[model samples]
Target: MESAFTKYTPTEPQIPPMCITLTKFLTTRIQETYNVCKRENPTNIKNCLTNPFEARHNYGLDNERNELIVYRHDIIGTFNSFEGKEFSMSPYTISRYEVIEKLGQGTFGQVFKCYDHINNRFCALKILKNKKAYLRQGLLECATLSMLNTYFDSNNDRIVKMYDHFMYCDHLCISFELLNQNLYQYAKERRHIGLELNDIQKKLIQLLEAVECCSKAGIIHCDVKPENILMTENGELKLIDLGSSCFENYTLYSYIQSRHYRAPEVVFNNRYNNAIDMWSVGCIIAELFLGVPLFPADSEFDLIVRFVEMLGMPSDEIIKNGKIADRYFKLVKRTNKYRLKESFEFEWENNIKLPPHKNYLYYSSLHDVIMKNPMKLSLNTKENNFIIRECLLDLLQRILVYDPKERLTPNQALNHPFFTFKNINDITPKDFYEWTPPEREFPFKVYGHSVSADPEDMLSDAFENKIIINKKLTNSEYYNVFFTLLQAGHVANITIDNPFEYGSITPKQFIRVFNHQFSKPSIPKVSTDVPRSFVAQIYSVTDSFNSVPIKKEENPLTIKHCNQSKIIIHRMTDNK
Candidate 1:
């Protein structure tokens, strides 16, 4: 074999220009050979082989410029790998808003008073962080805020307005109308300067109006402390912080009002409605008169004690319906033994001198004036304790009724004698503004909705129908209707079978039922029963014999044994 191979020398194949791949493969083989020798133990297969691509670069014969050009693609690709994965700009990011200053920060987000550069408008931008805990809180706040914004925008004037909301990256942003000072700051400044009685009365009336608007919307601002109220640039009052507020239909399992302002019903953990806000209003009104919170207690127990001291011990009826009544009231140590006077004593460290008679006597006298409805005095009264006190007491007492149901509604309060002053019909919008505090500002620049409509009319027209459309028909309607019908002994049993089901009754019929039922003096007592058989339609039978069919046989009359007299009534119609 050696003699034959000696005469034959093989020629090498023609090589094309060396490409990157070929160069890498050749370099890898050379590195592998060196590694195998360095390892010494050739049996190590892993050490014998090396990754060509990962090996250090080799110096090329070509100049630096050429070399740079050759590896340009590789370098660029490595740098650009993260372009789409780690970061990218979204369509909404085309325009950037200017950040003026940070308004406030909470666990979930930070609010910034920003100027929308694109729109040339000021907005409060809420930037929420994307975290599990923060996301949930953000979602809740967003829902509440969105609803509030919609409500205020629909009737914009003095309420906080939401502009827009969006998500950027992991952050959710909500923008609202930028506001100046909250009610807390306003009160602080006023307390330092001292508020006049006229100023106090004006603010109180504005607050009551705002509360009345909320009530009309069927929303209860569960949190109505000074902190939640806001002032605009112009002199007007606006209620804010609807995050803790709830719809009339919402049933909160846990109580959540501020300690000092919390109503007694809330303290006892009893079921409560919008009247909770009235209690807060009463507290605020009392604070305005005394220049401090009326029931500023340290603990829940102390709060209850303070309330009892001022309002007198709650009747057993109230206690039974309260939140912690069983715990605090039932405990003999905390019970009636501690009289109202003792509770009042515990509130203050020392005997504080009361304000001058001229300053506070008016408020004290006015307490029960409205509820009692005493005759109005002529404008030329002597201004004695009896006359002045009657006016003030009447106004305050109506606003501060213990029973929420008995409390004068905002509309009712507006119609009271307090607003029945001289030039009552001549008061202009400008005059109203003049009456408002300079430091206070309306949240809304433009009032979008009509305030002239009757409060009851604000309720959905569907409420008039037996099958209320878009509204929940409470048992209150049925109770009222039943009682009125009961007075007649024999009355129509109106069946409201799914009022929401359209075409069942005309809108006119619905309104008739609603007005008729709602006007009743008392709710009726009626028994209801479920039928055993499936019947899609309901029918009334005054007499069973009238509906019975008679059968006869030919030749001799055959009297069939009558099964136990049972009647089945059916109303067959296309409507069914």
Candidate 2:
């Protein structure tokens, strides 16, 4: 995927004949608007260009002027489109576009690679799954894209371009410009060698820029993983998938984000905000450097333990405010009253040790973990490298804070030295230059279709369920081992305990056990730093709050309170 545009010799963007008419109308309309606005206020055009929230393009018949005028919205490059397009009966047919092949499927629905028959160009079509209730979600995506489309630069547009959307066969179909691939796939190819730190930083700049634009738009992209970011031929990054986005005025969904990118607030079911995205950004940035997920956990509890190992327990305010803190953390009254809960956890975890698991946080620190592992930080081993290592960790800490209120916003992040840093090593040797197709913008660069993708393909391959049948144990036998674990000073629901009572638990049964856990897990620490925010399409079903048929409580674990500091789970017996 090579660029097609070069300075003044930019490639002519592909547009259907009808779109040409719309473009003319839009251009005339914009000129008229500028003329009228300039007569009233001299700085109107400048404001329109600079004001990110300002409306960029408006399409309508100019009844006042007795003519139809359209102001073309030139995003990364220039693109022209017409609204209210009608498609044929075929699912693949959408106006003048023909479906090529299915590109991918996501939480929103299926995305197809399509060709614009009229323009002889390729585009992507997102066909909303036919659900009457999900129409609102489609509309939310429309609103978000509309806001993003107008906020554009010649080649600096961050979000994917949405050309048009329409209803067909009871399903909402959206047409977007076809992209090359995504960051996830791109990163996977080079995970072993990994991307240069400078290149990684550049990618973050593009992603964070998109994030900042969302903040300016007053929208939250609840999901912000590598899979959602597309990379173009010219190395342009575009953020896609807005089905879960919501406005700042209200939250739509409570349960949001994928397992790995999930913020502490999301895991705890606490009140969340834009900070959630920042935490994900931190995770993404680390992966870009390490070529793997920063914290890849088998279970949610394991992720919490990783946090404890790196950063220690979250602040007391985080624990208290968390909606489901009891599900993971055991809040014991302190014997040392003078020490704050957070301070005590940090100090005692680092100092005191009574047995095999006296304090969880004592296991390792951020420096120890990175120094032990093979990361970008581990590559540089000079004693003077502490400053650079701290620089990298400092950036991670700012974004991965437990309290969303304290997390670094995209605005603050862009100013951080990590993004602004210019490495001396970036300069290439005069004789050793890497050559490629010349950097030129393509005909489709700005109009339709989009960037690349970065999905976690290796995530599935990370674990192997290879049990060699070393011994055959009954369900009762498995339960007996767990019972013994509980009897020997093990705690259920604590981050330390593996809560799988049996060898198998269905998603429903797992949720049930998770909902019942007493000791809560603290938000994972980011080596002492992050917060997260989310915009939801539907936080939860309205009926989730309604009355339900009550059933006898299922006590999976029978525990007796030994005291405020201790509890005992009675062993399971093979009784007749």
Candidate 3:
């Protein structure tokens, strides 16, 4: 049998700096691996390390722990194949941890339910893919987790407790205390019928406290959705998946958060801060009650449209300030105000059609969605229902504001009436709750653009305020052809004089670009029936000009995506 004290060291000459912190961990794991391997396979211990998969099969019958040795050499130099970079789910001994089964997978990598031989407990071991980019993100998560766990939640109460982090071959492996299940799964189990008010309050209060703790640490959990929040064995909540988190001072990525919970500022690609997280909180709270997403949008375009339908058009200043504002809103030359481009206009621009059952097409307002929730019928009385609904609506309105500056902070939200547990005896229909809502404001100048104090035109019910497009423009005519060219500033002007002669023009005669300066810039008009070639050229010119690099900036205070799998790996604990 191989010596129980034998330690298999990596043949790779130069180890990366990231593995330096794992020296002590690696030493302990090597000792544990050999000891476990010797006990499990005394006759042919050496052969187990040679091929761990075969070892797993050999020991499957006898060894109850199903122990199989995994060495640094097994994973480090392995080439990625068509099957992909995932390690097998057999009871492989990754360091000192004995993998029981695969739990879940996400953008980073797969998670495994493992038994810690040294600690004599179960844990969720997150195995990041061996790619360098994933490695960097994994390191950031480890650093953030280390900071939060050691400095803030040493008791393992608020944030998910990271037991240990180390390098297993080229993969960055992080072991976390086993958690029960995520909040999403919790909600799903209930058929998304919405949680009871009492239960909702308890979870919301706990989650708010967690958010406040992170805020105090200057960390922005860029992703704060139902899936990332895990429930403890005691039924308490702990925020997980800090991989997307970054310090408020040094916001790394602009593109953050899931599409459903994304803040309006983030959607606009404008400067954002911790308030963005608060926006997500409001969405979550609403979902907890409604049993469905408040704003379930198909795309970014659909999302903005929903925002308008629910809240209304943002102040003209905000509309003008957004980086990609022009994509969704058109500046009315006469009014000098921004109008949300008609849904059909976006369809024309992107060449993608939206389904009829979009949320915006059904829901009239944000208030309407909340008030009409069927879950409220479960309340004992109309008075009780009214109190609960009013309190929630008031809180949500404050958090889901268009401007982040106007949105409630985590601390402030904790103090809101929604979190206040009122006695049922004190509740009376005559005594209604009322408080002055925070005045919407844009206090700071953005990109040399002054805040528009045009209160008269600030908010418009989008359902009532509709932009009529020409009836002659059919989807087929606009679908396969034509792009937009900017007629914003003084440049070369190519005006199609006669709409009737558009179809007769050949490909070469399509664009007659000449230096025809107008008294003022005009919004480019889409012809009813322009040839595809002419439309394409105009769009091509617009794209070239739009490609010019503009300065991109993030909020200095808190400014913190693609839909990765909703399942959270590190927090999956039900397999145990």
Candidate 4:
């Protein structure tokens, strides 16, 4: 599609209306030119003035012949004494790029879709404005791009890759890999319909990975709204626009991030870290699910109020640390409690007439907002859908934490339960193949790996359909295993050859063997209930816990098995 800006015709330069007066200022200079069209021999041109100022007009003087001699196209373009901030049009070449059309415009400069003659491919050429401050910012963008493109973005897929950068027509032009529409445009094209849960999950995984990459480089992507994330044809997201980015330790601006996605620390002008990006990520995820921004505010004050409504009030410590906290909050002298200053009262302090607060729909917490969202999940059962929502909400709560120090890091979010397949039925072939196993933990060493007693690291994906023996399972864990197995198609007989001296088994001794021989295939579900006689043989009649077990009186619940389509576990043997 053509840009909204008027196309500049070669015959008439599309200068701004305000610049029209400059033509009269340079009229005397233009009149000094000789009419080459009226020469004794038209081929032999007479002296024509080539003053820099006359170039703004498309043609040289033809007062005598009253016809054009030197067309604007005849002269070679130079940077010296350029008039407007942007290049005129395509059919124009800047260095090796053949400018096709204007793609976009930002504070730094205008971006054009150009043909890279050398590479024989299309690229986005970002040409900085011919102004000092913009040029400086553009150069900084180039440096950050150079660092990321060289060291961090080794895959060339996480972030928008920069190809070449150079000065063209006195503008610092940086060429980047051309990508599809940004996320904002993508959602808009879909009429603001929320994305599918699976799609949102996939995008979040990639987005978090991208953010983690940025964190590794110690660069803060000061602006990370939907507009800054571009979707490839395959639907993979690539982060773009790091013009406002700065090193984590050397943040250049207190005012950063889009209003809706802005972190609280930024809103209060407090010291922020990489956690600010996580907050933005949380907002984006919420928006992706709701088909709109999580917090759409007309002003910073409104944004703070939304934050308060959606995520409770910030801790006193957090508010106290804010550099500009006094602008929005006042410390009560008697109680030392911070109170939100009224918007009208701040008008005098800031010398700006502030609008009255708009009545906003209130949510007790982010959980309430997410629960209210009409999210459609692929799960067949409502219970499964609710489970997914709750898992996602847990992750978002940590990400949207008011305190930067307590907010979830990209690495931590990657490990959140939402990304893991808690249900066997939810496990896709893709999920299995792409699954990364966490470090294992057990009381004793297994598979040449060190052992730890920590219960948190003990459970892995393979142990989802686990068997608990003398060790009674908690209600939550028991139900989790039951539901997981209930979804499985086949039940395999798991036999234990030997048990400890006490003739008892515990989860800590449940060695996870990655042997491929014990592949479990899904078949059909077994009966939900069994006779007491049948239950007695499989499970020990224990008063402490209520669990169904397979009958094996001689065997003391030694083998823990999973009901799965492909359950591969090798039997563990003790060394003599």
Question: Model 2's lDDT to the true fold?
Answer: 0.50
TM-score of 2: 0.53
lDDT by residue for model 2 over 504-534, one digit each (tens)? 1111212233245543212110110000000
Lowest summed lDDT over 10 consecutive residues: which window, candidate 2? 527-536
Higher lDDT: candidate 1 or 3? 3
lDDT of each: 0.44, 0.50, 0.56, 0.55
What TM-score does candidate 1 get on C-alpha atoms? 0.48
Candidate 3 least-lDDT 10 residues? 555-564
Q: Candidate 3: where are CA atoms >4 Å away?
A: 1-95, 192-194, 353-357, 360-362, 376-383, 424-576
How many pairs collide in each candidate, listed in order? 20, 56, 3, 6
| Residues forming the 10-long window of minimal summed lDDT in candidate 1 | 69-78
lDDT of 1 by residue, 1-576 (tens): 456556655443223213213454345334333433344444433321111212222222112211111110011110121111111112123234455555665444556666776567877766654433333333334444443344433566645775554433233455667777876677667665555544555666778787766665445678898876777788566776555654443433355788879877678776666677877987786666445566667676667655554555666667666555655554246554423333334335334432221222222222332223332233333234243444555555555555666556665655555464542333343433333222212221112121222223322221221211222222222222222232222121122222223221112222333356664212122212211111112123433332222332210111123332322222211110
| lDDT (tens digit, per residue) of candidate 3 on 1-576 | 877897878764335332442454345344434544564565445533322333332212112223223422222211221111122111112335666666776777767777777668888888765544565566557545655675556577789988765544335567888998898888778753435666777888889878876766556798999998999888999999888876554455678999999998888888766677888989899887777787888788888888898898899888788898888999899998889998899889989897664543235587877776565223433446766677677788888999877787777776665665555325443333455433323232222111211211211211112122222322112111111111111111111221111221111101121123322122222222322111111113234311112122311000111111111111111111
Which regions of candidate 1 are displaced past 4 Å?
A: 1-95, 106-109, 128-155, 168-172, 331-390, 422-576
Model 3's lDDT to the true fold? 0.56
Top candidate on lDDT is 3
Candidate 4 lDDT by residue in tens digits, 1-576: 988999766553234332543463244233223333234433333232221222232233322222122322121121211222112111122335555655765566567777777668888877665444455455456545655665577677789988765543234556789999988887667554444566667788889888877877666798989999998888999999988876564455788898989999899887776778989999988777666688888888888877887887788898888888878888899998988877777777788875555533344468876776565233433445655566667668778988776677787777765665535236444443343434312111111112222222222222343333322322111222222231221111111111111221111111211122143222111222321112221333342322345444222222334232222122111111
